[model samples]
Target: MELNYVISITDRDQIQELAALFQSLELNMGLAMLGKGTATSEQLSIYGLSNTEKAIVSTVADGESARQLFRAAKRKLFMDIPGNGIMLTVPIKSVGGGRTLAYLTGNKTPAGGAPDMNFEHELIIAVLNEGYSDAVMDAARTAGAGGGTVLHARGTGTKQAEKFFGVSLAEEKDILYIVATAQQKAAIMTAINKTTGAGTKAGAICFSLPVSQVIGLRKMDDN
Candidate 1:
């Protein structure tokens, strides 16, 4: 009875293949966008990644379905391979308004229960001034982050944001999506704070969402 948000990021060429997999799992309602990874050359070499071009696929899935897709991704997409890709799911606190929620759940009313915050994985989302994704990723790497996907996005409520911060909140914003273990979340957030926090020109705002499940992110054995 729980909803989960599933996100998959992989090489651009694999978009269709992965999408097909999602369709096979009935995760048909989704969107795909192009992005570029911000991994350093050394990092790329370490992960066996050859290109920076990426495709980010996202969908809203029920909890059980999300788990099924996660396992399929590891087996079909080679997600367990160091640099193949990463997928994660965050519990959805609530779905939609009354009717919309019912439709999504096939007439079942949303439990609307209090959200549970305890989790072992976190999704680090950082919104930064344009062109600063590399800087943010640099700090992230120093704090144990493997890599991140950068998406071109524009900010809204510029006036309110600028007034509150007393600085220009550029409409053009770059969003960095980084997933890390719960134990490493604090360090990664700290690193981002020092480099692009409110005091800096990047005007970065960072936060974390408790992830219920993560796939393709486990460290590979040396076997």
Candidate 2:
């Protein structure tokens, strides 16, 4: 079985509407995260750059479900409201992380059995440092990745430092996402870790998910 995730990045004002749109299409909202501009403001202020606000909404779903939601959004929302939003889907391999399996799919139903995220196919996931956009792209490209989305994010639970390491960590961050194949996953991660993780301070992180099924994107051409 392949698992797939539909991730949406938008401003605070659009979250509710986006949620409703997804819900209408039968995809359950799994997790939601905020994007504070504090760090961006600080970093930009240092160089006199302006700041912008954003948020991320991630949903777990099957390929058919994802396609339906995409169509709904496009027809209902027009999807080009000038910074209103962007939505995409990535394939995941497994869901053996936590109690999440049962939690995410209330029916305890498999992807095929219950539209509850049976994965339906296989895909890759890459986690990397906040700022290494270029490195992420380069590495993904090496593994047949044509493009990925950039998500503004922040680290949580920082009450630790300010003590042990004496290192004041900036909570603001950025996460780049690339969805490729089970075959391309490993190479992309290795390229990212080797170049961004080792050579730079981006502190790159990488991982993958098996995708069960997919919709649209006859153009992405997974190499």
Per-candidate TM equals: 0.88, 0.53
**How well does candidate 2 match the true structure in TM-score terms?**
0.53
- The lDDT for every candidate, in the order shown, is 0.81, 0.57
Model 2 misplacement above 4 A:
1-5, 8-17, 25-56, 60-125, 156-171, 216-223
**lDDT of model number 2:** 0.57
Candidate 1 accuracy as TM-score: 0.88
- Across 1-223, the per-residue lDDT of candidate 1 in tens digits comes to 6887788888888888878887887664678988888778886677676866988998877766777888888888888676788888888887558776655545654555645779988999998888989888888989989888999887765677677775455578888999988999999999999987877877778999999887777473558
Steric clashes per prediction = 0, 26
Cα lDDT tens digits, model 2, 57-128, are 778765566777777766765553423455666665567755666544443456453234334333444444
After superposing candidate 1 on the true structure, give the runs of residues whose Cα lies further than 4 Å from its correct spot.
106-115, 167-170, 218-223
